[model samples]
Target: MSEKFQKCVEDFQCLNCGQEVSGNGFTDHCPNCLYSKHVDINPGDRANNCRGILKPINIAPKKSGYTIFYKCLSCDLEITNKTAEQDDITNFLITLKNQ
Candidate 1:
């Protein structure tokens, strides 16, 4: 089966910080707290049933930009997302330092 790479633009409240986040077709994590919900198995496919709160654990420098690492608090699954333009750089730095 071929994976569909679709952009599922949807606004949702952050499960961790209760922040209202607006999705710009690619906005995955909350810009305020950098928290994301484990809703998609593929990039915006939303096929995953593990609806766990994705907690920001660390940040790593990527060639394109930076990637934020997340760990599912409920299921212990790890996920990574490339840093978004609207993401909080301050929080990203803090996460990088703590790593």
Candidate 2:
């Protein structure tokens, strides 16, 4: 299998905040709430079947951008995602504070 994260662009409703999120081909987390689902083992592969809610727990600065850390509420799995350009500033700040 190819070890690359696929670019799957699909809109999904935020399970945590109940927001109708529009996918931009690279959107993984909800822009309004910054919450993501534990759907993929790798970036857009969607091979994993955990299907848990990934809650934003912390943020860390990286060379390219900020990395948002998440902890799965159901499975206790930890994951990280890069900060998107369209991410909300207020939510980003709130994540930083909670880190």
Candidate 3:
């Protein structure tokens, strides 16, 4: 789906694990499992409309970025997100070991 940038609201329930999630303006993953659903093509923009379960598959440390890989649980959509502090979760360390 095409993307149109817009502001995002918080307190969304994770479509993957059915867990309640909140975005303090920076969070993008479920706190329980570190998984995210493909809700937008651009960050904070509700454009993709896929509503697919985006699983954390791998992690890559960039020279000036933090990468998190995701594969959708429904349509196999893939998405990558840069790390953010408000995105703290227990599964982050485990994801880093993948790559």
Candidate 4:
């Protein structure tokens, strides 16, 4: 049986940007880089074996906040995550545009 929303809170270093991330239970990505790891089959379950780096590609604005879109570097899997309070979406978009 697969579990959903396991609520695992752990600190991690970003593989892409080398940022030390402090996870708050719901943290699935780096606030500095908006990058995530493909570590869960379901939210917080950490059951996925891919272990891919999920790069932020785009964002969609919503009423509450924004939804971040990501694509896995290793497996090309696409996913979406809601923006965190500390996420630097503006800087990311600016850097993305400059690239």
Selected candidate, larger lDDT, 2 vs 3: 2
lDDT, candidate 4, residue 93? Answer: 88
lDDT (CA) per prediction: 0.81, 0.82, 0.73, 0.86
Poorest stretch of ten by lDDT in candidate 1: 1-10
Which residue pairs of candidate 3 clash? none
The candidate that achieves the highest TM-score relative to the unseen native structure: 4
User: Which ten contiguous residues of candidate 4 have the minimum total lDDT?
Assistant: 1-10
Per-residue alpha-carbon lDDT of candidate 1 for residues 1-99, written as tens digits (9 for 90 to 100): 765534488888988678899888888789977889888878778888787999888878888767888999879999888878877768656765877
Please write out the lDDT profile of model 4 over residues 1-99, one tens digit for every residue. Answer: 754544589899998789999999888798887999998777778888788999999999998779989899999999888898888887688878998
The true-structure Cα RMSD of candidate 4 reads: 3.5
Candidate 2's C-alpha lDDT? 0.82
Error of 4 at 19 (Å): 1.1
Worst 10 residues of 3 by lDDT: 86-95
Q: In model 1, how many backbone clashes occur? A: 0
lDDT of 2 by residue, 1-99 (tens): 864444478789998788898888788788877899887888878777787999888777889667889999989999999878877747657656777
Which number leads on lDDT? 4
For candidate 1, the per-residue lDDT at 4 reads: 50
Off by over 4 Å in 2: 1-7, 95-99
Model 4 stretches astray by more than 4 angstroms: 1-7
Candidate order by lDDT, decreasing, is 4, 2, 1, 3
Candidate 3 ranges beyond 4 A from true positions: 1-7, 15-19, 63-65, 88-99
